[model samples]
Target: MIHILGKIFSIISIISLIFAIFTGNLSQLAGAMLDGASKAVTLTLALVGTMGFWSGVMCVLQDIGVCRLLAKVIAPILKFIFPENCKKGIATDEIAANISANMLGLGNAATPIGIQAMKALSKANGDDGTASDDMITFVVMNTCAVSLMPTTLIALRRAAGSANPFSILIPVWICSVVCAAVAVFFAKAFALFSHAGYKMKNARDSAPPKTRESKAGTE
Candidate 1:
């Protein structure tokens, strides 16, 4: 997938360069590229401080046992969502940390925690090549996680000179909740279908084969 994406991007870049040359806009394109690079650097610098602050907050929360408290609060929900993993008490702590970080709008902090959770889940699954139901559910939840405080987004808005950076809070809450529900619904639906198919296949495979005499008798 990475290779395919790289090839697609290369093709697009080549096509754009050709178009720019044909239209005699090569200099303009070059200037635009430089301006975009400058903006990217500026944005990265602006986000650096916000990311650092959130990272520190995550550490402080952990040190103060807030993470554990939050984990305990959400334990029931996690158990419901990750029955298999929760049954064996696997990846629970990592999962809780990831969720907590996401809720706090610490995406950068959540990413590593999410990766650790995935690794724990994969290990518990015996390192199987295929993703398990729990992994799928986790991915869905992580991707569409609810953010009670979208600090990163607010920082970006502030950097962009928004009159009211926090104006998006309500909309973000609504959108995140809706997206998470929809994603979880689909993930669970697919898992249920997969399990049903597997059970049917197993039953068919375990059934006795019909003998020639039985076939004749039936006929």
Candidate 2:
């Protein structure tokens, strides 16, 4: 679906470019594209700097075994969400770091660690390119992570000249908690339903076939 959307957008962009050229507005289009690209580059650089600093901090924490400690701390929850087989090792550490970064509102810093965790999960799932129950649950948690600091929002507000930059803190916290709880609840509920369905299917598949004598006796 996402690939299809990307292709659709690319086709629309090409058509717009052609129309602009035919209408002799190519220069204006080029200027707009250049301005957008320039702004994108600037934003990319800003994000890179932020990601670098936070990633370095995460690296230091990992070097000092903080990620491991955090993994241990969150082990029970992780075990409940993930498959019993994949609950240990670097995957758990990556998840811990990702969650830590998210709580601190350093989502850029969390991206790489989250990717690593997904890779670990894929490997655990036998590289089938299908999302497992644990993967789905992890995605739910990551998407709805409770942001305690929301530093990015605060910075954006400050940039926009807000008088009280941190005024959104309480609202952000409340919203994050509520949304995360709701997302987790639904994801777990679906996971349980899917597991039950699979178990029933397996049970039906393994049941004994009725013989001719058994069928006649039943009749």
Candidate 3:
């Protein structure tokens, strides 16, 4: 689906550029492209410093084992939610660090840890890289993660010249909470539904077949 969308957008861009050239608006197109590129570069530069600072902070937390302490606090809840590996347990330290980065709204910092967690989850699945229930649950949690600080959003707002950059903090928290709740609810619901279906199928497969004698006796 993503590939298809990318192709569609690429074709649209090509067609639009062709149309602009035919209409003698090539100079306008060039100017617009240059302006967009400049803005993108400026935004990237502005974000780089903030991202680096947060990443370093998270790294320091990990080195100092603060992440492990946080992991210990949340381990029971994590184990409960992901029962597949309840016995073995997931890598709590990595997950906790990832969650911490997310809560701080350091998405760039969170991404590496999130990737590590995904790899750990994939190994726990014991499959050919196919996503398991725990993996799906983690994905849902990460997608709808609550951003308590939302530094990135605040930065964007500041760049846009908002009078109060952090004004949306409360709103962001509310939305994140609602989204995460719904995400977890649906993920669990689907997991239960699939498990029930598998059990029903297994029971049917294991049931004994009626013999001819039994059928005749019944008749």
Best by TM-score: 1
lDDT of 2 at 208: 46
- Model 1 score (lDDT): 0.83
Q: Rank the candidates by TM-score, best first.
A: 1, 3, 2
True lDDT of residue 87, candidate 3 = 68
| lDDT of the structure predicted as candidate 3 | 0.76
**Deviation from native of the Cα of residue 24 in model 1, angstroms:** 6.4
Query: Ten-residue segment with the worst summed lDDT in candidate 1?
Result: 210-219
lDDT (tens digit, per residue) of candidate 2 on 37-148 = 8877766655565556655765676578664565566666665555564445538767877877677655667889899988988897788888876678788999898876
Clashing pairs in 3: none
**In what order do the candidates fall by lDDT, top score first?**
1, 3, 2
Candidate 3 per-residue lDDT, tens place, 1-219, comes to 999999997998899799998999988988988898899989987777766776677667667876556556666767767665666657555776777667766576678998898888888667576677777888898988887767667777777788998889999999997887788789999988987776566556655454433434533
TM-score of 1: 0.72
Tell me, what's the RMSD of every candidate?
6.3, 7.5, 7.0
